[model samples]
Target: MTDLTELGVAAIRDGVAAGSFTAVEVATAFNANVAAAQAALNAFIVATPDKALDAAAKTDKARAANKPLGKLGGVPIGMKDLFATAGTQTTAASHILEGFIPPYESTVSQKLWDAGAGMLGKLNLDQFAMGSSNETSYFGNVVSPWRRNDGGNASLAPGGSSGGSSSAVSARLCPAATGTDTGGSIRQPAAFTGISGIKPTYGRCSRWGIVAFASSLDQAGPMARDVRDCAIMLEAMAGFDAKDSTSLDMAVPAWEAGLSPDMRGKKVGIPREYRMDGMDADVAKSWDDGIAWLKDAGAEVVDINLPHTRYALPAYYIIAPAEASSNLARYDGVRYGLRDLPEGAGLQDMYAATRAAGFGAEVKRRILIGTYVLSAGFYDAYYTQAQKVRALIARDFEQAFQQCDVILAPTAPSAAFALGDKTADPLSMYLNDVFAVPASLAGLPAMSVPAGLNREGLPLGLQIIGRPFDEQGVLNAGLAIESRAGFTAKPERWW
Candidate 1:
């Protein structure tokens, strides 16, 4: 093997379990890669080498004592900064919570640790997980490890909210990383970076200590280089938590053990609404390729229409921001990270000043949009209507699911675009999630698996969405595509 860092979650766990290599060896190799690549990739906001080493020590001792290893034994992964890890500064990449370290760990992170995973560090993300690109991070934007073959060598966006998680996994800095999807944050970034990520059904993973973006839409999952690794990591991350009111009280399934790519007797649906005019040629071709792949896997392909899909993006924009506005109100100058108290000001002035100074441009924009939509005069005209659209979108998926086991679509409108390509145009940036938001609105389990490379040598991905609590079906569809697509291209290590 070239390096321990090249191993994925399952490989690393089995390797450590069998005494082929020590957990410390794997952790050390990944820690070095993370340190060496930080300047160029900006993937991590903080690096916790000691945390990894400490976890490895415990694992090594457990093995020596013949103690049973957990599901993710010996793997070190990135914790997206949105999760509140005990004693680790958990910023949602926002200045408002710059140095705020929670006394308690997030339920998801705790679950990972319980399953023998170690935290390499907290990863960077769009500030408050708000933007489509990683540019909104207060720490700085994360650059993809990829560069186009067109010779300009202009940096590309790694995709947002979960950009740091995607970049780190793609670069082999970590085997897999935690990612939360509010509106395509996990799947879109996974598609952009040529990796696999799943956003489980809403409430599948507890939202207890995750920095809230959209209360009902945000769901945590895993990002890895391939489908099986994502399955393994997700199995470790998902479970019930009483602390979160929205947490599913049902038992977590054995998803990793249940994974299979065989699609015999499975019906795959191609959403007719997704084949819109002006779709990129590369994206359209990849969708076609995905259809053929599922067919080759012995699955039957059929046409399905999600009539409300055209309204998904608009509805998402309204609902997510509106929820974010309500969730973010607790970050006042009184209790937390950034307290911008002017010498002669009262509480309300401090609240205004702190928010103005602490929030990024995109965050403020969303907050204003949210506040405006939730206003007394416009609430029914905007937020209420958006919720109704969301319900329609969900019903559309429910009806479509009756005709098929899973739905296939393109992950994004295009492959990874240049860093500044849509920065000046917010609407253009929002369109990147057009193909991804419908599933989020339905609160379904969805995934993105790398399909192939575009003409520019950047990757394109195919999305598989399944019914609620049906992540196994989504992962299986993704596996069928992963095996056939043979997406072995990794970003060249420029850092």
Candidate 2:
């Protein structure tokens, strides 16, 4: 039998349903792996092996009783810390949120539970999901399992916000994990860790319980080892939610059953704007390889222009932070999270002290930027202008999609950089999302598939952006890349 930890979500689902292996065994194996790697990887913010085993036991009992299992029955997964788990701590990797546990489960996590997925633990992420690198996590930076081909022992970052989710799935600590994408949070990290992840079109998944970053752009999705696994998990995670007004009111599409590697008649758009100055040679080559793979799968490649591409990053920074300032205002010490009340301090003094003490540097920076843009005089000049540019960016995609079914581009400008390398320069760090933010601003469905390795043996990912409600087309394209890329490279386990 193959390693239980190494199996994909679909395989695990089928195996548990067939009684070929008990769910308890699967949970136990992954629990041991998580325990062993916790120190080196720093992927999980908290370990919930007991919860996992309890869920697994229920799955095995269901099998014994000849009852139907849910879509994720007996499968274990990591919950991103941003999601509010009923009993577990749901910190968004920030001191402000530390020790805050929700009495209610997030809609997406609850759906996974109802579908039979076991909770392994809450995974780490950047504070308020702000940083490109995982270094800003309050717990500590998550170390990627991959090393450079030159055999340098330096630790690399698992691209952030969803860094821990990517690290755990790639290291085989869990079959799949939940991730929220506000601006490349899911896709960028998945690319860095050599896995598959998709950010469904905005409103496809409920935002009811996930911590808010940008109300308009945040979306929940699946991160898994392969496209099929991501498809299966996504079906269970997405659907209409009355609790969230943003959630679509339609039934979730059956993406798993409809998975196909055929792209014979599909038109894949190669955006001319993604070829930026100083793009890494390896990244360029991988994008070229992705084009060839899609062509081999029979997709007709067409060059399309998105004229507003340059404005996406600037617009996103402004809009996301503006929303962040509003959403995060509730964290003032008067409520549940950490409060810094000085002796005999007044309400205003306490609020200021708590925020100053609780928030990290990066989170503070974003909040300040957000507040400034939304300020009285500057609001029209900065925030309003950015919103207008955002509309233009969406229009650019709308126009481009007329000539093509989906767009293909590199997931990031370069491979995973060494930890601490980009921490000093905030601008450089923000550039990591250059290729990913455009689709995000447009509220489009996008996915990242591991394409191939760079010259120094780092993995490179190719992104596919699809039109609204076209996740099936996006997954189909990803499957085509997965079949051709044959990207089975794994980080050598030094831990």
Clashes of 2: 0
Summarize candidate 2's per-residue lDDT along 70-152 as a digit string, tens digits.
Answer: 99999999999999999899889999889998999999999999999999999999998988889999899999999999979
Task: Write one digit per residue (lDDT tens) for candidate 1, span 1-495.
Answer: 558888889899999999999898999999999999999999999999999999998899899999999988899999999999999999999999998989999999999999999999999999999987899999998999989987778989999989999999999999999999999999999999999999999999999999999998999999999999988888878888889998888888888889888999999999999999989999999999999999999999999999999999999999998998888899897888999999999989999999999999999999899999999999999999999999999999999999999999999999988888899999999999999999999999999999999999999999999999999999999999999999999998878
Best by lDDT: 2
Clashing pairs in 1: none
Q: Any runs in candidate 1 off by more than 4 Å, and if so which?
A: none
Looking at model 2, report the run of 10 residues with the lowest lDDT sum. Answer: 245-254
User: What is the overall TM-score of model 2 with all chains considered together?
Assistant: 0.99
Cα lDDT, all candidates: 0.93, 0.95
Candidate 2 residue 126 Cα shift, in angstroms, is: 0.4
